[model samples]
Target chain A: MPSRSLWVPFELGRPLGVPDDADFQIGVLKSLLGLFNRKSGPVIEDYPIESPVTAETDAAWSCTIPLPPLPDTTTPAEALKQALLQEVGSLAPWHAESMRRMGRTSFGLSGLTPESMPEVAAFLADVASGENPEPLSGLSEPLPIAIRYMADDAKAYYMEAANEQPGSDSPGGTRMWTWIYHETRMGQVFYDLRDRLASEYADRMAANGGERPPGPPPINPISARFAVRPEPTAP
Target chain B: MVRLKDLPKEYAEGLLNLPIPDYGPAPWTDAPDLKDARVAIISTAGIHRASDEKFAGGAADYRLIPGDLDFAELTMSHVSVNFDRSGFQQDPNLVFPLERLRELEASGEIGSVARWHYSFMGATDPSRMDETAPRVAKLLKEDGVNAVILIPV
Candidate 1:
């Protein structure tokens, strides 16, 4: 518990409500700073405005970039790898445009550049297929950690490019997330990796008497959960 | 929206059932007026400079973000993928609000922006932060930060 806290009923990632709205953000700051005048203890105030993007649903939004058809391969993982690499290649120009305009991106969480995004996808595909490939670019983190970063970096790369397209900003991140998981081959790749990690995690748990073993298990199940968002069920 | 009724049933239940840490009695201090207060932002959004170490699962450490650091240089390596990163990707202000604070300073709403801000990855057990909290408080005091806004995402 904080001595003074202002609770805003915004979406999970957005604390100040909407992005790119200066007046609203300033208003939030004023509300928070105004708490100082109360001279009271442990004040937990609720912010009074509902974010415009709250529970925002964008059913009409879709990525404009068309991906090349997936190549047929004997191995399913290889097909995923090829398709993901092509997907990244197709989005490169738009991502570059977004970079030119924004001057920076959140795409390098895995220590790999946006140009190296295809490699990150390939790494995950390999892991998904049950091969323990050496860490790319000599990253010293364990396989689970590397997998988590690569997965995040993959989605980040795609979202940055999508943001460059028209109508990308309408409903905010949730819409983009819906598009990523429901429409793209990259989304399929995420599901495959999650399934692979889940198997490994179950084995670890079973060996440890149905409880997680201490100090970083061989596979972190959380990574698998983070890698994919399941399609929303019908009410 | 964060109202329990608005969230998915499982997630809302998880949050409701979470064990609230007992931090003993809440400490109280009267803050300086908004115009006289030097404010620092403390976010649990797992954001930091691109060069900083990534937060592993349940890691308790925090990162220092210089107020003047370029927004593009900031990145998030928070361990959870459950939250939306799209907002932060589109605008850093939604998470950090440094720009908003700067506007307030220019308008004379607050005394000043602290030269440094801090971020810690959320989802870490708060009890694990016991050792580091005091040190952060000391640093805030040294920088004349009489008020801090703890933003959770």
Candidate 2:
């Protein structure tokens, strides 16, 4: 397939070289479209352009949205649920702004809506309490995306509510997401949930005498060759 | 400059191990002259018009993107978190290239842009794509497209 594909060395999630570079983008398009001119069985072309951003640079970047005190290890399930509900309520404005900018999100894979976020909060709180809640229903493409968006938005809302900054200058979705996924207590919770889920699946596979599914390699933050900065400790 | 093959071992394994259909070499078809051919684009970036249903779970589904639609009216709903979306956020042309195709049409580099383009969420189950591809090919044939450019994200 390499002979038939045009390869670009851009980061995951970005197929084009960079944001806001029309000339570079147009060049890529021209090069790709040029493939049709070949009367050959297979052809592979390497894009010459280099992306200015690197994983190191991206990893080093952090969001400044302040976060509340970390939920104590002994935090009750009901308390966590209450906090998540409040976070969702706080994110209403930001979510609305995102919708206005990007159009209504098409992510409703859990068959869950913002109106039913309490159900989601309850599920997460249960997971946090080390309870094996029922698996999310409708495990599909956009459903997982929708659930992620919900989790991200909840983290953003919690941070914003805890921040000293005025509401007039709230961070955008990307910044909030970067911060939530990379730093903060909520990020840890999300990561923990992911790890637990992976472990459970692996156990299930083992029980069924099936091989565990392949997944992306784990991040090695301590590697000297590709050192990613340590995440900030949650307050 | 890591290509898809260079992705983290686990990620690459997941994608590389996807069940791809065993397809043989297709007979080579010479492209019509660029200045006379009707060109169309098909992207596996999971793009859809705002009015269309979002793609879900390796769906064997596709959406039609009218040639005249605005980039702002398009959105991506793929599940993969591996690609950088900044370029797409800034200029959807990075993935869809609707505007670039339009420019080529205006410049006569291509005879015309197809009235409709197609999109499927890439990184989907290959079997689903295998099923959907022929249907999309039929649609392209109906639209009289002479050349196709496939972009994968």
- After superposing candidate 1, which stretches have Cα over 4 Å from the reference? A54-57, A138-142, A168-170, A204-235
lDDT of 1 by residue, A140-203 (tens): 3655677777778778888888878775454666677766776677777777666777788788
Model 2 / residue A91 / CA error / Å: 6.7
Cα-based lDDT at residue A81, candidate 2: 54
Against the native complex, each candidate's DockQ, computed on alpha carbons, is: 0.62, 0.34
The TM-scores, one per candidate, come to 0.90, 0.68
lDDT for model 1 comes to 0.80
Candidate achieving the largest lDDT: 1
Give lDDT tens digits, candidate 2, residues A21-117.
Answer: 6677777777877777777857888988776665544554443443444455456455555555555555555555554654533334344444454
lDDT of 1 at B3: 80
TM-score of 1: 0.90
Model 1 Cα RMSD, 1 decimal? 3.3
Candidate 2, A46: how far from true, in Å?
0.9
